[model samples]
Target: MTKPTLPNTTSSSNQKLPSTAHSPVFRLRDMFKPSFDLWVISWILGLVTALSMITLLMVSGWFITGAALAGMIAVGSHSFNYMLPAGIIRMLAMARTAGRYGELMVSHNAVFDLLKTLRLRFFNRLAALPLVQQRNTLHASQYMHRLVSDIDKLDEFILRVISPWLIASVSLLLLAGFIGWALPLSATSKTIIYLLLLSALLLPLMASLKGIQSAKRLSQVSESRRQKLLAPLAIITQLLLWQQWQAQTKSYIAQDDRLQALEWSAQKLRSSYMLLIQWFFYAAVLVVLFSIYQLTDSSTSLTTGVDVPLVLAVTLGLLGIQEIVVPLGQHYLALGNSISAKDRLNALLQPSVSEAQANSTIPTDTETGLALPTGPLHANLTHVSAKIPGALVGAKEVSVRIDSGTPLIIKGPSGCGKSTLLQALAGELPVQSGEVKLNEQDWFAYNWQDQLGYLGQQLDIFDQTLAANLRLGKPQATEAELLSALDKVGLLTWLQAQPQGLQTPLGEYGAAISGGQARRVALARLLLKPRRVLLLDEPFAGLDNETRERVWDSVREHQKQGLLVVVSHHEWDMGQCDVLTLKENVFID
Candidate 1:
């Protein structure tokens, strides 16, 4: 039977890519993915912040101008109490300060919470992907960039994106209601209010559209720089010994230069948008001033005594609205970054086949189901082949079978398929042909993931304490269990020498320790949770010979309980263990 294929083109020159389950319109609710209550408080605080500032500025202006006029007139001091306005001014000032601080605190907490959610989801997705899918540097870097940086940029979703538009919308409505009540019903009042309304909405909409392409490009280049910069940092010694550091440094400098150019382009566009908005504000100010002049040029009007203060209030209110509306202009980049990051992430992290086929069940019918054996864990591979989704080469027509009490060592030349075979056995890949089974059942059918332990060549060290990192493998492991595992991996002496021992922070990516120590720490983590089957890929790559022997001795002790599969270029002494040699798509024992 032929497998499925997505249409590569449609009726247009510019083709639409097939949409995946991961694609969705970015929502403000996602900003509160971790803590809804905190997000709600953040939004309320933001509203309070804007309302307080508007009230403080307009009320202060009115009170100051009105007091001056009252003092100048003969009936001045006794006409009204001066203390009320003065006290209100002081109260508004205090409210504004407190609201601003609360807004920052709540919103920042919301942002940090959102970031934690994103990082956890990202790592989980990567963990779920097949090794073949993971080997694509393009895909991996994009995932990493999103995991480390794009999620941080998304904090703008709060301050710039949602909060600005919401506050602006609410302010406009309140201003319109207040002006309609306060001003005389005239052509001038109608014109000022309508123009103010249009300008308030139109200016931001235009600004959001203007620099979008620049914003999009900057986001892309920023991701590229992150991928390039971190890759070399992870393998600085190898690159330096290969004598490629100078070229890498020069290329990184070029990336930085390109970044500067992109930022300058975005800056130019943002500046133009800002200056244009300021002009619209100036026009609104002139209209308000003209309206005030028409109202108060003479002293016999109905609102005569209050006219100066009213004028001050109206003019200052308009200015405050302009200030509140400015943040919306800077929100373009947030949208751009979100779109880019989501697209890249969705492409790499499609849901697993088991998840998609959740309702499908295994049957004991003779036509299809094979009866599983008892007493030992069994894995059988028959002419199985697996490949990276878009790559040119992979394993083909390889066959193998192993059960408990067998240690399998896969030996092959470079570009052979040992790693891919291990991934297939680990349930990380589906065979394009033939079959793989555990105990006579499809490996994915019976919760086999819990029964398997896999340690790949990649060294993943979280920013956590030593014990905390080790505890990830088996969260409920006791202190004695941890110490036993560390001793098995030869990290006990090293752990004791640390100032804080198990409490010591590993820093970012385990930068606090040496390469061999990091590897052993990872191995210790693996040892903390023993599984029915253990697959170790290059577990001894950076270890000394004695440490490697000790590691093998520790693992060999577990051969009775289950199977062991190791992939390595270096030869080791094997006592009755099976060896599979893969060459040009053939497996030989």
Candidate 2:
């Protein structure tokens, strides 16, 4: 079988391209704003703790230097005290360990709080965006990956990336200050060394930016291919009779080889970059050692022969600076990947063109709490067409109307735009060249959500209790009201037969129930949501004859209360209902 091809339009091409800047960073910053106070407190505490640890390391070096000097004096027949140095080292170590633990606790809490905020913001943004817009931008799996994987990258940014650099930087600055005040090494020399180390750290990052972008793109492609391969392979048992195992294996191997090549190329580039960084690191260490040696030799009279304590401190500090650069480089690389992922997610969460505005007025009926005007509804379409990408053109010049509380049966072959017409009526589909009106008012003029209840051909069920799914239509509905709706839909007996009754979990997409039962559950939900108009797309397609009759009966019973528009190829025995046949042209009576 041939693989499906996506559209070759400009919009399709544009979607294939990735954004230059990661747009989600700005959004993430906004999300973290609420936790700023806790973040600030945590950062301050972390800095203090880091300083304490650094001080302890420095004091331990001093103790070592003191013990060596005392031994030297003892060999020269002189006495020197080592008790003070030992006591101070022990005290500093204890304090440093305690401070480290405290900092960890505070930082963990702060980062977790920020992560929660990010998750909420991401979900809220998705909620605000229109469904069609989201579908156009990202696949459901990609969105899930971003929500799980990309959000996790922030943890690396905080813990493995930012905190260590911060601590190292502050410690270096404090050491430089103390050395300039207490030793003969001029502040100018220290400043030069610091600049050289900074250059070594930054040069690799600048050189690797383009490479990082390339790697990220390649990784995304690789991931997409992997998902494509796995999704079908997962259902292989179902297709085993038809699909050849050898052919499938060969195809997967070919795709895997292509992705592996790209991955290897990226890895090679990264390795080269790291090699350069390693060389730079060695050069920087040599430069630091030479500078210290020159300073000590030149100021022999200005300070006692290069105190071992200070020399050891300088060596350890330089090593810490070197350690800092590696994390910084890795941080930048990780950030590039995260930014790319975030940008994709941000595009998905952008508002749709058909997004409803706040303060939009909705027509309402006082008695039924349904959104329909007092007059009759006349829907019109003149040269209207819905051109969806990768799908058939929905409908053209499809003009139809139903007077108050009339049942209209839309008859057409599959993919003949029957559902599209109903969707247009519900305001889900955009009218390209014509208008749709409810109660003679422009559909856009009134909020349509409260006015219409739609059930698509494919029924979707959540992994929740059966009662929870029904309650989605009416959250405040009591058990008695729910039982009544179930009874009306002829599902009450089935519900009672379940081991847990209404409290039974439906599993993902109602996987625990049969197709007919899932349809009934959806029907129950629709019944609970009182609406002025109902748009059902083959709601009875998968039901048995008896269940189908019951559902049809339920629709006929509800017709007197509101308008019912149904799209189905199956024959119905309803009386006094007008049938609208949609062939090349819509025929309505």
Candidate 3:
């Protein structure tokens, strides 16, 4: 068979995209843009609730003082109508209650809606990342856990920092205006009150700005500590056996202590700032009261100056506003937390250098798209240095060629980069400074997904029925085909023993199946759709010797006309094939 001529595809590496478009400010703004209307409604409702609370307190105080004075005067009490004041108090109370309820409902609904949108965007962006970046840079739970926590912090951001600060500002401004209208006050009193409100608002912001560095450090340290405390069981045991358990334990404890110390410092900082703002508010209240008292002329019988009832009302209203304002000062920590969360999320979401290169370099044949070599497909690597991203060492200056006739077995000690080398061939790790060619063409110039099958060490089983999972390999596959594939992997007996057979549920991560059965099931699925190249990482792990040989024979039979590359610690007793052993950047056969 002659190799088919494929259309030439150009790499996108020369294409330059502007970097400023992805700035943190722009990203945050973009995050909010989708739910802009919801955010607006939330802010408006928050302001309404806060204002209602302040007004309700003010009116109640006025009504109580007026009624008390009227009762004391006897004649005044007989003529004074209590019904209007009582009705007004009831109305204010209702408004306060209703507004608060509405704000809570709308705000929480908005948060969930916004989070839904953000989570979708986050995942979409994650999917768009190059396969190399996904496999190498990110491990099991590290990024996934951080993504959840970071998203949760945004909930706190909207509710605690953004909502409270916005409500406080507008509420304070409106209250100041209302107080000016209700009370006969001098410019000095208005000035002092306004200054106090402004100071109260800015104090939290100042504290947030000052603590940004510390807050970021706290976030980092906390995550590090968490990861340390939850160190993988495999790693912990290895360290224990190495006699380094004491040092590792000390390190974990040290991280815990540092995390606690940072938290304590943050609490102290917030408390100190709150105390300062509270003291200023109290002093301002005294000053306002004194200013109002100076307007009182006792000889004039409460006509020339502010009335006693009015004085009492304004004083109580000032205190009411103070109550609303104090929480703003306490929001500094929340503000810092939100900022830090935003920073960390942005950093994580940003594409790595290799990802950017892959985005720019990977190509597709638009004219004659994805021409899988019909003749023998051969994979060749030339001085290919590749590593798991963020790792200190990996395969370096390595070269190998995988041919179609004989399968390739990669043997190496753990951490010797055998898997990394396999990933390089599978196009899941970008080469540092070499060429990976398939059929004498740059692999990136063609789409290899349709022509390649990879079975990693981890099982890719879902919580689904056996037939449904089998259908994933060949969606239109019939029952007979499913049975044939299972029997090929020596699982037909086991399947027949199950009452439901193909309809049996696999449970989460194939929890219902043994490790060996899961591996065989995965192998059968891969066999259902044969590929030009098959890469299996520890495919026979967890199997007995007899079962392992049977599964190996099935795999070899399936891939006889194709190419096979496997990474395993176990010895294969099969006939002669290519064997490559990796050791410290060198490839030996």
Candidate 4:
């Protein structure tokens, strides 16, 4: 038998990628393969704990009834012998307590281990995605919020849905056997007991089938509602300044109302299902009591027809079984959520059809040998029109040629696809029409990503020391190289002002520094490593005119022997660089 492998992908352009259409359930099963032993241990402990509680109640009921009847007669009281029964009851109590504690400890440990495995697996797959897919702003935000919630929901697959049903079914069977042996039940009573046991098996399965769609919808609406409420936080100040905060608050309230309606619908379904189970069990209990009454009235004495103490014990045990059975109905809600979560996580691994098609056309010759050509580097875009994945506006019919000495500066308004054009050049956005070529070859054909440096609007900063963070761009960079890059980005004076200098911690996402300082630090990090081509988006953001001009000079000097493409809103003193301006998605020379 072949071992089932988890989903895996590659960033290679021409490699024949394996299909990621693995079954979701199969993937979920694979997650538990590593922790099989822990699951078994937890399951056994849970079964033992449930059975112990049921038996404890039955035995306690029997002892109490027997003792009470014996006390009614002087001669029988001496023969009853309370010592053994009391000792048995004490042992049972201890066993019940110990089993419950052990079950909780083992089950929770197993869940935590499963959670760790799931998170690691998710991150591993996430790392395998293409750089373009990874940098998508909207998708990135959704992934962070949904990944945590979806992974957390998966724990219920084992805890509430699988284990509870297994333990309850087994305990019910054992209790039925004990009742049949201890008391002489008639055909009618036996039939009722058998029917109740059958119902316990069938009802939860039915309820889960009905609840699946409801639970799935609840999960989706909840996530949507969360995103809706959080979307305004990024621009709350602007909204308040424009006197539109009230409108945004009203939109939030509407989304919240929709979420609450779905939540209530799910809760109502679960409650109704549980209530049905409770009433059915209660009705079965009454039928059993009526049968007992009929058997007693027809017999000469209670001792011959039915044992009254054993009957009472069975009755109480049936009531205990009701407690175990009701939860089976409730867990169907969790079953639906887990199934939905599993499907969503599975979708992440599958390669999109368009990406696969694009990869198919890549030439085999260009798969290897990613080294750039000798002498000056040059890039050409022939009538290239591209857009961000979901956006409507982007670069249209743009044709340009940029050589090593003459850098290209892209000028545009706020939303005129300047960044999108840079993204197209860096292979981060797919061209809808035309082609981007490096040295007269297809841009995608040459695996020159390592020799290419691209910076987006967001600064990828980490909570680490200045030197430590700079080391990310060039792992083996020396102290002098690090200081040189910092000087190029005009952060030398700021670094000198810090008490710890190179060792100063940036705090989480560079919160300890000013915006301009953080931006310079990010730029400095990027410049530490040499690249044949550089694409920078708004590189001079948050900088004063003097600082911006100083950094521009350094940038020009750094790219003297390479091609440079920049997107900027601010005008600069153009030396010899070619300018392409974008207005309403069309580029003009």
Off by over 4 Å in 3: 1-26, 74-78, 228-247, 354-359, 363-370, 389-400, 411-416, 544-550, 568-589
lDDT of 1 by residue, 1-589 (tens): 0001111111222333224334543444566667888877877877787888888888888888777777777453588678898898889888888988998898777777788887787666655443334444335656655656665666665667677888788887787677666766467666776686778678778667655566678877876776678877888999899998877777677888899998887777667666667677667767766665676646564355436676678778877887877666655566666655665555446544432232123121222323334478878878878655554567888889887887888888866878877766664454556776677766544444345677766667889999998988888999999999999988888878888988999988889888778877887887876567788887787787888888888877854678788898877675778888888543332
TM-score, per-candidate, Cα-based: 0.73, 0.79, 0.87, 0.87
TM-score pick, better of 1 and 2: 2
Preferred candidate (lDDT higher): 1 or 2 = 1
Q: Please, what are the lDDT tens digits per residue for candidate 3 over residues 5-66?
A: 22122345676633622555224455567677877887887677777777777777778887
Cα miss at 441, model 1 (Å)?
Answer: 4.9
The sequence of per-residue lDDT tens digits that candidate 2 reaches over residues 1-589 is 0001111111221232323222343443553475667666666666666666666666667767766766765776446567776786677677667766777787778778877877777777654434344444454565677566666665554564456556656665675566555445656665665565566556655744664586577657766676767766877886677766556666667768887887777667666665555565456556656656775646462254667667666555555444445545444455456555566556556442223221112222222222446555655444455534345445667667665566788897766678777655554444445665556555555544445677876666999999998988778989998998898778899888989988999999999988778877887888875566777888787777787887788776765677778887888576777687766533231
Prediction-by-prediction clash tally: 0, 0, 0, 0
Model 2 alpha-carbon miss at residue 210, Å: 5.4
Alpha carbon lDDT of residue 102, candidate 3?
82
lDDT of 1: 0.69
